[model samples]
Target chain A: MKKLWNIFKAGLVTDNPLLILMIGLCSALAVTSTVSNGIGMGLAMTFVLLFSEIFVSTFRKAIPSSVRMPIFLIIIGGFTTIVDLVLKAYFPELSKSMGVFIPLIVVNCIIMGRVEAFSYKQKLVDSIFDALGMGLGYTWVLVGMSAFREVLGNGTFLGVQVMPQSYQPILFFILPPGGFLIFGLFIAFNIWMKNRMALKAEAAAAKENA
Target chain B: MKGNARLGLILAVFAAIGCGTLAVVQGITAPAIAMQSEKALNESLKKLFPEAASFEDITETLKSTSKTVSFEKAYLVKSAAAPLGVAVKAVGSSYGGAAKLLVGVGLTRNIAGVTVLELADTAGLGQNAMNDAYYVNKAEKITFPGQFKGKYLTDAFEVKKDVVAITAATISSKALTEIVKTAADAAAAWLENQAAPVATPADQAAAAASGAPAQAGAAPTGGK
Candidate 1:
């Protein structure tokens, strides 16, 4: 259980796809303009990541290293298409808003990196927890970035007018530049938090030695 | 050689499974996707003509008469008692890509309403053209599409002249105006052609040769 928790924690903080590893930043920036879009994209990515990890882990031994890349792509691409079709059929509004980004998920580095690095060697149960952790880690950061962008950029949260009507929205917060600015701040904050925790851990170890 | 062949076989098997799975999923969602788009179109048409009880597609009829401007889709909007007007969907090239618009033209040659169906333009600039919340006239609370209501089909459709342009988005504004003009002109020509069916072939040829249909000159009777 502790090991599972550690794997999950790694995804959320120590090895966050966005903050630490810094893979799959394109969609994260592009879709973080709205809170709803962020949540929708994050969940959709989670679905694809979770499934791909499961398939890769379950068939790890059977998949020869020589042809594993193609096999991984097939699984990832198939899952992405499924997500796209399902969103179009059921959540047409979300499907429209996200546009080509959903199909672009097949190429997201986070999924590919996790599947290759962790799931390919890990057991089934461990892969499951890792997938969930990584998925939620990606989700929380997206939601955080989108919340800041949407609230400031559009003067709205999840499409509702939360800011006072008198408050003039700064258009800069919603643009591509704004996405980069917020992403930088998030990385900085994550680094600071990690540093603080490391210092505290070192101090505790020294105290135990004394 | 044997190892390579075995690897290829495994890859092919995975590819086959992936394709089969996608085919199944696509088969399941295809119908629902079609229905959703149709539903969306109907809803937009209803929004344009609020009192419209039903819509009959007149794309073929309109296509025959509308030689100057082409429309993607044309519909005869109708109420319970009588035909209200014609609605046409037209596309114009914007800065980024195609901007699709739907314009409803009343029988009195006045624009009933205008709606944007699809737009692939630059975000924050060109996209503000269709955003209702981004008002062109804050005091009047008038949206970009809102200005088109009750406008005469003969009015100048030039951006920054008769049409108000979005801030720093002249291309988007011009594209939308062009699409609206095309839809309105197509609707007008078709409506005129339908209204005056007794004209001789010579007169029809003259009208077509002129490249502009003669105005019906009928006074506005407030089409209910």
Candidate 2:
């Protein structure tokens, strides 16, 4: 139980998909336009990541050391394909909204990175916990970024008007450039906070030594 | 294998696998992808004339010939009524790059409506031109394009200021307007040759089947 807790905790904070691990940044940047699109993409990524990671872990011992990377890639590509086909057939609207980015999920560094890094080295149960944590981490960050952009950019929440008429909408919030601007600002702010925490950590370490 | 040799072999194998994976995906998805495109085209027509109980290719003759006609003819997607609208593929340069719209104007020949079947455009601002209320309204309100609705063969094409372009969406407006004019002309030419034979209810069922949406909701590239 303690081991499981450690795995889960590591994934959420220490190696969060967006913050610490910094994988899947492409979709993170592109689809973080609206909460709906973000959530749709997050769910899609979670399912894909969970299955691919598990499948890779299951086959890790079987794969010849000579061709493990190739095998791993084929697995990831196949899973991404199935996701694309299923979504196109069933959830056409979300598929459309996601656009090319859905297919681009095959190239998402996160899926491949986790499978190659942690899952390949870990046990099945540990990997599952890791996947769950990472998935939650991805979903939450995407939702947070999208919520920030949507409300401020559109003057609405989930498409409902939140602000009164007195406020004028900053049309730029919905533009493509605006996405880059907002994401950059958030990333910068996070980096600053991290540096501040690091300084505090160093100060505490110095005081302890003294 | 030595460490360096093994690394090289692994890299080569990985590259081959990536290429092979892409090939397999591109191969299998290619046909489905192409079919989805046809579905999108047909769906666009259906949206314009849902009541269009039926549709037939009156202008398909233009596609058969190898003769170089600078001006290719357009096609008709008729409703169960006397005839619903003119379905034509149009290409124009929008804010970003070349934009393709499948326009189906009313038989009245006025700018009825359109679907940006393909577009590589800036998202949201200039791209909003795909929306009905914006592009369709602006195209028609200007009177040059929409006025074509009810015009006979002799009506010359025109674009006026009243067809107010979206605030920052001029390129899109220009591109669509050009396509509409060419398509309207081609449609008019095709109509002149053909007899106004409206299809019976039996024909409507077949057309309805043909007009159902392509891949329902395919991935959105940059298009709407």
Candidate 3:
């Protein structure tokens, strides 16, 4: 259980797909304009990532290294289509808002990276934790960024007007440049948090030694 | 050689499984997807003509006017008592690409409403053309599409000069205005033909040929 928790924590903080690794930044920036879109995209990605990890881990030995890339792609593509179809059928509004980004999930490097680096070698239980941790980590960052952008950019939160009636929305925050601005701030904050944790850990070790 | 062959076999097996799974999922969702689109179309039509009990496709009966704008479909909105108006779906070039719109024109020769079906305009700028919350007149709560309601078919559909353009989205605004105008023109021409008490074969043939009936006196006077 402790080992599982550590693995999950690693995916969440020490090795976040966005803040630390920064593999799939394209969709992250594009869909973070609205809070609902951000949540929708994040959940869709998590669903795909979880299923892909499960399949890859379960069939790791059977999958030959020579043809693993193709196999991985097929699995990933199949899951992405499922997400696309389900969203279109049930959540048509979200499907419309997200547009091509859902299908584009097949190419998101976070899933590919995790499946290749962690799931390919790890046991099923460990892979599951990793997938959950990574998925939530990605979701939280996307939601945080979207919340900031939507409130300031559109003067709304989740399509509801939350800002005062007199507040003038800054359109720049909703554009591509604003995505970069918020993303940079998040990264800087993450780095600062990491440094503080490191300093505290070092001080605890010195106290133990004394 | 044996190892390579084995790898290929495994890859083929995985591909087959993947394809089979997708095929099954697609089969399950295909009907639902079709139903959703149909429902969405119905909802849009209902929103445009709230009193309309039924809509009959009249695309074949009407004639398209603008060379640039293509008329995709037209529907004759009717209540149980009488024909209400016409809804025309038209497509035109926009800043990003093709912009599709549905324009509802009443029998009284005024626009009932307009809704954007598909738009590929830039986010926050051109995209606001369809956003109901992005009010052109914040005090009156008049949206980009809201401004078109009750506008006469003969009114100049020019962006900025007449129609309110989306802020910093003149190209998108112009493209949308043009599409709406083309649709309104088509609806007006069709309505004029419907209102005519008697149509001679020659007049019908001429209307079909020129896309503007010779006896179009009742038609709203407009030139794109």
Higher TM-score: candidate 1 or 2?
1
RMSD of each candidate relative to the true structure: 6.5, 8.3, 5.1
lDDT (10s digit) by residue, model 3, range B16-79 = 9999999999999999999998898889999999999988777766656566788788888888
Q: Which residues of candidate 3, in runs, are more than 4 Å off?
A: A207-210, B1-5, B58-73, B81-83, B91-98, B120-123, B186-224
Ranking by lDDT: 3, 1, 2
Residue pairs whose backbone atoms clash in candidate 2: A99-B220, B39-B214, B108-B149, B108-B150, B109-B148, B109-B149, B110-B149, B111-B146, B142-B163
Write the residue-wise lDDT of candidate 2 on B1-224 in tens digits: 58768657755765576567657766766677667655766777777667766566543332211111112224566554567666766555556666666656565645555566555455445655553333345434532233334444344433345344555657666666666555555554444344344366666444434432321232322222
Writing each residue's lDDT as its tens digit, candidate 1 over A43-116 gives 99999999999999999999998788889999999999999999999999889878768988999999999999
Q: Pick the candidate with the highest lDDT.
A: 3
Error of 1 at A5 (Å): 1.5
What fraction of the true Cα-Cα contacts (under 8 Å, chains A to B) does candidate 1 also have? 0.73
- Residue A134 lDDT (model 1): 94
Model 3 lDDT at residue B205: 57
In terms of lDDT, the poorest run of 10 residues in model 3 chain B is B214-223
Given the true complex, what DockQ would model 2 score?
Answer: 0.14
